[model samples]
Target chain A: MDVRVDRDRCIGAGMCALTAPEIFDQDEDEGLVVLLNTRPPQERRAAVRIAAGACPAAVITLTEQDTSTAP
Target chain B: MQHEPSLTEPVTLPTQRAAGCPFDPPAGLAELREQRPLTRMTYPDGHVGWLATGYPAVRAILGDPRFSSRYELLHYPFPGGPEGPLPPAPVGDMTGMDAPEHTRYRRLLMGKFTVRRMRQLTDRVEEITAEHLDALEHRGPGADLVKAFARPIPALVICELLGVPYADRDRFQGHADTIMSMDAPPEEGYAAMAALQEYMAHLVAAKRADPSDDLLGDLACDSDLTDEELIGIGAFLLAAGLDTTANMIAHGTFALLTNPAQAEALRTDPDLAPRAVEELMRYLTVAPTTVRSALEDVEVEGQMIKAGESVTISLEAANRDRERFPDPDVLDLHRKATGHLGFGHGIHQCLGQQLARVELMVALPALLGRFPTLRLDVPADEVPLRTNMNIYGVHRLPVTWDED
Candidate 1:
């Protein structure tokens, strides 16, 4: 899965970081989302999905890719 | 604006919960949600507006920018309330302001309440929670948990964060109470708000003259925000952070007391604290209702909400929506209750949410652990409820524990 976060849209409520600390972190200064792993492995998908869904700002977006078909 | 013949008679907002069911949303609101999730309502000023009760409707209204948060555009939802359009939100009260304006104030404050920052404050929250628990034990056999424990932990934490002297809690807390009290006369609430702003102005000036290492002090030193803005921000943060968390602690305790099985589950397993807090927040939903005005005409759930009309979103009712939460009325600690509107949604979501979570995660479990046999000192029905306040909670939870 591919993950992306929009810092401009983030209100820094920190749901993403709290929900999926491995995939996302808030910048120490502004607390806006900081994407830790843009392409998290399959094991981390559930947490990522929860984090995205739980975000109040809806700042996190995820794209699913077929790993077997990829080069 | 064309209204359907069926929409001629509008339902007034329901304020009273059913007897003996203190934890649930008002029965009338639940019935309304069941019948029509989104319906027209008559405001105090005779303005016809919308009332949203379903979880999806509330979430969609809050998330949509077509709906404005501007205070001036809103029609007061309650009966016999203030008439005409309300005044514009005060300079730093982001709750009543829209983006660009709200964005500036929110951005400056966001960094202070990040997940990492709140985590850093956990040790201090734990210390504060422990200290309050100690006090409760020292004075116990029985005590009003609201005063003796719940109110002080968050009050002190917010004071420390803002560099406000803890000794002055009574002064600011009184002002905050008046501001939050729905029963307070409009003039009195205004006077209390003015007094608080005046106090914050002085604090900001002090912070500007001799900067300290705290939220207000940092803003005073670094930010280019004006004095009025700083004062507004300071008072807003205090009023926002103080009672909301205090009430949550009190109400969560009351809920747990009433539901012994859930309390036991939390007390026995330390790991359940996080999920327990979320469930409690969803169940209790202290800061219940919020209003938003439509900036332009919008269609929601196939209903046309005309421009300039307001919609009162019932966070409490939404949290209890059966579509979103199965057996929504039950307080199940094991339930995964994320995405609840307990702290609300969208850009204007609760700024201090992470901090509130830290305080709750620390305080609630510790309270249950400290007093295993804790239960209400009075009959559950006899405990006073803060029904008249903008935030809902027990006015004073008289709780007791078996002597060790």
Candidate 2:
């Protein structure tokens, strides 16, 4: 699965980090969010999905790879 | 441009739920908006008054100088007042003053609340949130988020911010909650204020004797501020800084968890937290109402508001206004246009907004990242709303995260 964040859409509320710290960190200055990794390894898929769901801005997009599509 | 109060069969104002108190008016304020966008209701003090529920009317009342934020001591409309008897003043006192004087008092302590200053506390906020989450394991099932999580984290932050000893946090946190409650007995509210004031007096004295590198210490060393002013500012900071954010952290979390999609979104994309928190603030609208009084007789939307009439600005109403937001009822975290009165508007807007924002931005994301499987024990609707208070929040939020 791949996750993407529209940086400009971030309002710096930090829900993403609360949701998925492995994927996100707040920039020290300006409080803009940074994506540590857009395409995290396989084991991390669930965490990525949770982070995307918790996003208030709806800016986080989770794209499922073929094998990951089975619910 | 103001619209006339929608003149339909009168429905209750949301604040009326508390037996005619101004605290939680009526629910269909949306209806009132169609009726009279700007209109008067009875004040607890037995005076007729204006209530501004529309987005423009609310913002105008809040940001414009025609209205003042100084009715804190008056006997105008509504319920409680300083007129009955002197209540014990809380941690600080500038909350009762207006503009120039209010501005002057705020300026003395303003140096400490800047975004830059709050950044210094972000790491500590994260640490505190994590520590609390860790402690939840010991709390086991059905721990109250209000007591265990929400109350303590901000209590500690405000304590450390003002240089108060951590051991004294409980007294002040309790006092802060009491003071923030709209339904609190007048005597009880006074006592909370008194407790806070006495607490700040001692802290201020200690700071004077041996100043530290904290906000209280900075105020202590300032030559221009009198001891009285410093004490007043302390009380203001304590009540203003602590209780509001405490409610926000609590309610914001409750808002997210109830909306599983929202919570799930956070779990997957921690980077979206900052924006999510903003959306939470917009949706939760925790600080529901702000009161202001007309400084001068003015006409808005063809309704004449006489000077000194108290006007309540509905933050939730304003945020939900159809004019400012599309699909106002739906939660859209990614909405491009993002100016809401969640923190209030204008000069008297929350001085601690930046600090509160930082705390949420850091704390909320960190919380979800650490507890991936967390889910609420009770249905979201079953969660009790904060009882009869202007500050809306859940009484308790119980959730279980996956063990291991």
Q: Output the number of the DockQ-best candidate.
A: 1
How large is the i-RMS for each model, in angstroms?
0.7, 9.5
Q: Candidate 1 has what TM-score? A: 0.97
Per-residue lDDT over B1-404 for candidate 2, one digit per residue giving the tens place of the 0 to 100 score: 89755553232236543332222324677667765777667655455666778887876666566776654434433355444223232323644556666655555554456445577778899889889988986666556777787777877888788777879777676887787777787678778877877887888888899999887887788547767767767777777766677777777777667566877787788777767777777777778776767778888766778887777677877777777778876666566324577877655656677688878887777777777766778766666777566577777777777677
Tens digits of per-residue lDDT for model 1 on B123-211? 99999888878877887598999998889999999999989999987778899999999988777988999999998988888999999
Give lDDT: candidate 1, residue B156.
Answer: 93
What local lDDT does model 1 show for residue B373?
Answer: 89
Which residue segments of model 2 deviate by more than 4 Å? Answer: A1-71, B1-12, B16-26, B72-92, B138-142
Query: Fraction of native contacts in model 2?
Result: 0.00
Candidate 2 lDDT for residue A66: 54
